[model samples]
Target: MVNYALGNNVITQIGLLVHDIEKTSRAYADFFGVDKPQWFWTDEAEKAKTEHRGKPTEARAKLAFFNMGSLQLELIEPDRNPSTWRESLDSNGEGFHHIAFVIEGMKEKISLLEAGGMPLLQKGEYTGGRYAYMDTFKDLKLLIELLEKDR
Candidate 1:
C-alpha cells in the first residue's frame, strides 16, 4: 500500500481552466441536464490575502461549482493576473487544472509536499477556509490543491 503525503487519497474536487467560464459553465450545465450554477468572483487580494510564487498578488478568478456526487467540478476563468490559474491557462491553454483534497494541517502538508519536490505555487484564503496549489504537474500530470477548512 502506498501512503500519501496529503494524509488521504480522496480527491474532493476537480478544477478546470477555461477562457470563458460563462460559456463553459453553461455548456456543462446543458450537457449534464442541470441548471447553470451561479458563478462568482474570488475575494480580492485584501480579503483573500492571495499570494503567488511567494509574493502577494491581486489575482482573482471567476468561479462556478457543480456538485457531482462526492466530488465537485470547478470551472475557473482567471483574470489577467499572475495566479496559478492564469499561468496554467496561458502556458497550457484551457483544460484540466488541479485535483483538490480537504486537508487538516495546511503548513505541515505544504512542507511535506515541498520537501518532496512538489513546491507550493499559490495560496489564498476564502470565506471559511484556505487553499494552496502545489506544483505537482511534472510527476502527477496535474496540480494538486490542498483545501483546509476552518473548524
Candidate 2:
C-alpha cells in the first residue's frame, strides 16, 4: 500500500494562494496566536529560476511563512507574473494552492511521480534547497509540491 521507495508522505508545508497576503497573514497570526510572519519578496536578489506551464519564466511572488511545529503555513501573494500561484488564483481564486512534502531522494521521487503521469509544473530554489510543483490536481485533486531541504 505504502510505496516507501517513492518517499514518505509527510506534508511539511501547506501553501495558500491569497489575493492580499497582509490581511491573510494577520488573520492567520491572530487565529493561531502567533506573531505575524515575515514577508519575503522572491525578486530581491536575482530572479529565481523557474518555469510555468511549459516555458521558462521569471514569475515572482511575496511569501509569508508561519511555523507550526514541523508543519509550515505559506501564504503566497503572486505578483503580475506567470507563476503557478497566479494561475491557480485565476483558475480557482483565493484558496489552497499546493501541499508540500519535504523528503530526500527527490530525483527518484520526481521520477516516480512523473511515471505516474504527474508532470512537473513549476520549480525554483532558495537558500540551499529546491522545490518542484507537480500537476497532479486532475487525479489527486490537489497540486503536490516536492521539497528537498539542504538545511
Candidate 3:
C-alpha cells in the first residue's frame, strides 16, 4: 500500500543515488528525453555535518533535475563520502536511494513518524526549502523525506 503521508496527486521527486554522476545523468537524459539536470552541492547539508556530526568536510554531490511529464526526477551522486548514498553505492552499486515527496506539516510529520517508528537521520533547509531525512531504511532501505518547497 502507498503511504498516504505523501499526499495525493503529487510526488514531487524521485532521488536516484549514483556512483558516477555524469554517466547516470546522461543515461536518464537519453532514456527519458528530458532536459539536462543542474548539478549542485548540498551546502546546508555540509554545514550541518560540521555542527552536528563534527565531520566538517565538503562532499561533492552532483544533482540533475528534470521534468518527466509532470513528476520531477532528481539524480544525486555523492563524491566518495561515506554517507548513506556513498555506502549504498559501495555496497549495492548505483541504484535508487530515496524518493523525496513534497509535503505540508513537515515538522508534525517528523514527530508522527518518530512516534510510530522512523527516526530522523538528518533534517535541514537550504536555499530551496525545508527538508528532513527520516530513517526508514530498516524496512525499505530508502530514505523518506518531507519537503517544504522554498519560494
Candidate 4:
C-alpha cells in the first residue's frame, strides 16, 4: 500500500460553493428533514490570518455546517474578495469545492503536497485550528483541504 504523506486519508468534510447560503442551506435541511443549521461568517482577517496565493487577504465567507454521520457537508458563500473559494465559484459557477481531512504536521504535509505538484492555494487560522487548501484538482479531480486542529 502506498503511504499517504498527510497521514490518515479519511475525508471529514465536503465543501460546496453556493451563491446564496441561506437558500441552499434551507433546501438541504428540508431535503434531509433536518433543521437548518445556523450560518456564520468566518473570522475577520485579523483573527483568521487568512492568506491566498501566498499573500495576506481579507477574504471571508458565510459558512454553514451539516453533520452527516462521520462526514460533514459545508456550504460556503464567498464575499466579493479574492480567495480560493471566490475564484472557484466564479470559474466553475458554484458547485463542489473541496474535500477535507483532519491532519497533523501542517508545514510538513504542505511541503510534501507542494513538492508532489499539489501546490498550496490558500491558508488561514480558525478559532481552534488552521486550514490549507491545496491545488489538487488537476490530479485528484477536486481540491484537497488539510485541516489541523490545535492539540
Indicate which candidate wins on TM-score: 4
Q: lDDT per residue, candidate 2, 17-50, as tens digits? A: 9999999999999999989988888753254577
lDDT against the true structure, per candidate, is 0.93, 0.84, 0.68, 0.94
Write the residue-wise lDDT of candidate 1 on 1-151 in tens digits. Answer: 2234677789999999999999999999999999999999999999999999999999999999999999999999999989999998999999899999999999999988887888999999999999999998878888999999999
Supply the TM-score for candidate 4: 0.97
Give the per-residue Cα lDDT of candidate 2 at 119.
84
Clashing pairs in 4: none
What tens digits encode model 4's per-residue C-alpha lDDT throughout 89-136? 999998899999999999999998887888999999999999999998
Total residue pair clashes for candidate 2: 0
State model 2's lDDT. 0.84
Every model's TM-score:
0.96, 0.89, 0.76, 0.97
Ranking by lDDT: 4, 1, 2, 3
Query: Backbone clashes in each candidate structure, one number apiece?
Result: 0, 0, 0, 0
Runs in model 1 lying further than 4 Å from the true structure: 1-4
From the highest TM-score down, the ranking of the candidates is: 4, 1, 2, 3
Better of 2 and 4 by TM-score: 4
lDDT (Cα, tens digit) per residue for candidate 3, span 17-58 = 776777877887888777667577776444534111223334
Candidate 3 regions with alpha-carbon error over 4 angstroms:
1-9, 44-60, 138-141
Off by over 4 Å in 2: 1-4, 43-47
